[model samples]
Target: MSDAAGDRDTDRGRDRGRGGSAPFAPHEWQIAWRYMRARRREGGISVIVWYALVGIALAVGTLIVVMAVMVGFRAEFTDRILGAEGHARIYPIPVVQDDGRRVSAIDDYDALAERIAAVPGVIRAAPMIEAQVLVSRGSANSGAVVRGMRISDLQDLPYVAHPELSEGSLEDLTHGIALGEGVARELGAYVGDMITMILPGGQATPFGMAPKIKTFELVYVFRVGRADVDRSRVYMTFEAAQDYFNKGDTADQVEALMAHPDLLGSRANPTEADAALIRAAGHNRVLWTWKDANGAFLSALDVERAVMFMILSLVVVIAALNIISGLVMLVKNKGRDIGILRTMGLTQGAVMRIFFLCGAGIGTLGTAIGVGLGILFVIYIDPIFDVVNFLAGGGIWNPEIRMLTEFPAELRWQDVAASAGLALALSYGITLFPARRAARLDPVEALRYE
Candidate 1:
């Protein structure tokens, strides 16, 4: 037994002799990495290491997915709302009430519309008049907004794209009237029903109180699925609305639609700039972007994203804790080895760097794993959402159609970069405590204890 022990030590001495110059190399990183690998192998990359990695990975992936889904819901819902309504509406300044009076403007609106359309990134620009009116079919009465639209004006807008035809066609839109599906259901009126609409007339008749009453056959019924607009929107021809609202020849406002609804407020694109310019025009008109139109919903999405990031960052923090514990264990297990290295003229900083390399190795490995999982889940998110929706009985399949029918996803490189950078930074940050302790070890005491 003694001879075997002696031979073992002799062979260890020879191996150490052969590799003595390894640590003296100019490329300290290469030498430090080699040493770190040897120590990590000795410490055993156990099942616990894998569990820690998986935990971090799952946490990061789930955070990313949840954030994306929230974003998807917001984006999808907003598009539907914008489509049903219109993007960027311009209303004349000083909105008049329903008093018995008339507000008149002699502005050359056709020339203005032409000039507005010529603005870069302005896709479609059209004049509109919106008025609240009480619509009735028989004894059933429903309140709704009567919007006057020109077919040629909003041809490029998404509101008219694949519009759900519950009753009459788009051609009949000018001749008769179109009722929202929800409105039709509530009023108990169908396609061929004639309805009476009462608008608050600006002029008082000589015989007591008065409001304008007009009759029209319900020509079409369209469903956009937004609860607010679906149940309260009634569409009429420009001429019909003019006579009803007592505007004679003028519309109350103009509606414009842009290309991308996502880039608003923050990004200064030409589309947003043009919308601003039209708003800034001295025509006493107020221009509103989609952001302004749906500020509440958009703000909710932003708040949720920030909250999710703050919550998920805790997982990275916990992973860093595990790294600290693991490195401390390694230092305790290699106490005698560190003392010997110190005796062999390894500086305190070098000792600290060696341990730092160990912790960094774990961080690098775990970060790679987490990032890989996040990417994989993001790539296959649609299928995953479908499965989830299918199992959940498709509760959101038709979500008021304020957005999109299908689940929409967009993987931004900026999000990926931010997540990966945070993970790596947190990983590197936790090693300092353990590395400092390892560097300050008393060589005499460590050797004596061994």
Candidate 2:
């Protein structure tokens, strides 16, 4: 080969070497990165970043803590209700009254009870009769709901029949009524005290008001903490309630206890499920789930949590706005560099990607930092909660009575996934407009201005 050809080849090798190192050399990414670094070095921008970070941190931390608190209360209360009441209850729509005027007796109740007990998830099904009446003890008066239950049937459901009996023995329920804590307090009656009960629909005798107004001695007192329940529950023998309430040879309804309470209402159509159970029991009766009984309260809690999440999410939105401002400023500051790049060979799309990455970088970093901080706070929430309680004028740590006495936090993985996903989406969304504008810049005009 000629010397001239060799010289040309040498020039081509040098060019290839330079091009190979071009990616590592100072480029648009480096320029954008340097701008970011410079902003950090500058006290004003650094302070803004810190402020944004703090805002994001507090918002996420408080949201997680508050949500956990709400969940804690809901869970605690629901569990208590489950323990005191069965997962589902079956009852007659219109309670069979004793007019003694040709009433239809439920001869199939025994078979029904057995069938309900045979339901897939049901552990036990028992006949139940509930009567509401006014109880008086020498001028002291209180309204109470007397529940008649067979001791053998009740022994199967321990959550209700034997829940932390404060002062009464289960055996006493067989002979005499067991008074709830509030009922005992209101009637000014105690164990061994005789109380007269007046059934609301008692048959008035010729002697005036004599539908078996029997005086039953209180044998036990139970404290269940729930205001509504603690004030009214009284347990009597099934036969006793049947005789007094004229519920002869028939129960008011039947109650079923399930293995999985949460899955009680999960059936697409509960009528079908109940029908299956009734068929299994060889009786046709209506079944009511805990959801049917307490839907309003549960829905209120769900709405409250959703509102709190939306309200708290605004804090993060505002912090995300700060990222927008930071990126816009970076784009403006790097306008000349972008113009030069466009003059060379960088496509408008590539320019857009550069700005997009920067914004996304901000979001990614911020979200990561925020999540780490949130988890840390959750881990040490007990101590922080104590500090807050102390500040609120409780010595050392007064248990928080709003939901629970102690700080209870359950960090749902789904919540973490949702929060981080939202942050990324918002970050990317915030980038689009500014990135497009930066990419569409008139290189000639920008370079001329520079």
Residues 332-439 of candidate 2: C-alpha lDDT, one tens digit per residue: 767897889777666565677777776777777778877777777777888887788778886553222332234567677677767777776877788787788887
lDDT of each: 0.70, 0.71
Error of model 1, residue 131, in angstroms: 1.3
Across 249-271, the per-residue lDDT of candidate 1 in tens digits comes to 78777776667555445223345
Query: How many clashes in each candidate?
Result: 6, 2
> Which candidate comes out best when scored by lDDT?
2
Q: List the residue pairs that clash in candidate 1.
A: 76-403, 80-402, 80-403, 81-402, 168-220, 225-400
